[model samples]
Target: MSRFRYSFQKIVDLKTNEKTQAEWILSSAVNDLRVEEDQLSDLKHHKSEVQETLVSAAANRTTVSELMLYQKYLDHIDHQILNKNAAVRAAQINVEDKQSNLTAKMREEKVWSKAREKAKLHFTAALLKKDQEALDEMSVSRHKQPS
Candidate 1:
């Protein structure tokens, strides 16, 4: 008996490769998003520390110039935080896009996998039928032989 071979094996291999590539891309995107979120968190933490310092300084006797400087620094931190927030949002969007692409690749791979399984089942059934026919012919000949 000949071995069963899937007709679309090449297509199945291509789909599997595509799914792997998509997974890699999605992982990279997720890492990027995590980095962006960490940056945003650090910025917020720094801003809070600066605010605490400004409040403590107000409790002591401070020069007008020094107060203005602290205020200016705080304003700069606010602007930086705003930019970091925007970056985090953009990273989130990129992550979502990568996830959708991965999903599409998974679906493509599944379709090919299902097709291969169906082909294997059909081949197996045909082989079984052929074997049964051969056995039936052998039985008929044996019965016709001399008792």
Candidate 2:
């Protein structure tokens, strides 16, 4: 029997490549999200430490200027936290979008793979039928010959 070749083999390969690329994109997005989340956590931790220091200063013999400075610093930290939160949100949205794209690519790949399998099965069945016909013809020719 001849080698079975899928007519859409190129399409199947392209679909698989697309899926792999999508997976890589999704991985990158996830890494970005993780980095953003870690930065936000660090910012919150720093803000807490500053707040504690400000409180301690207030309870001690700190001057008004120092207190005002601490307050301003706290305000600055708050603004940074807000911006970091926004960044985290945006990264999360990016991850979601990448996840959606990866899902689509995977589906496309599966469709092409299934089609290839179906085509291969058809090819095998046809080959088997041809072989069986050849065998039957040979058997009939032997029966018709003199013993």
Residues 1-23, candidate 1: write the lDDT tens digits. Answer: 98989988999999999999999
Candidate 2 C-alpha lDDT tens digits along 81-140: 999999999999999999999999999999999999999999999999999999999999
Candidate 1 — which residues are off by over 4 angstroms?
Answer: none
Each model's TM-score, in the order given?
0.95, 0.97
Residue pairs in candidate 1 whose N, alpha carbon or C atoms collide under 3 angstroms: none
Residue 40 in candidate 2, Cα distance off native in Å: 0.2
CA shift at 142, candidate 2, in angstroms? 1.4
**Ten contiguous residues minimizing lDDT sum, candidate 1:** 58-67
TM-score, structure 2 vs. true: 0.97
Top-scoring candidate (TM-score): 2
Cα lDDT of model 1 overall? 0.94
Candidate 2 least-lDDT 10 residues: 1-10
RMSD per candidate (Å) reads 1.1, 0.8
Most lDDT-accurate candidate: 2
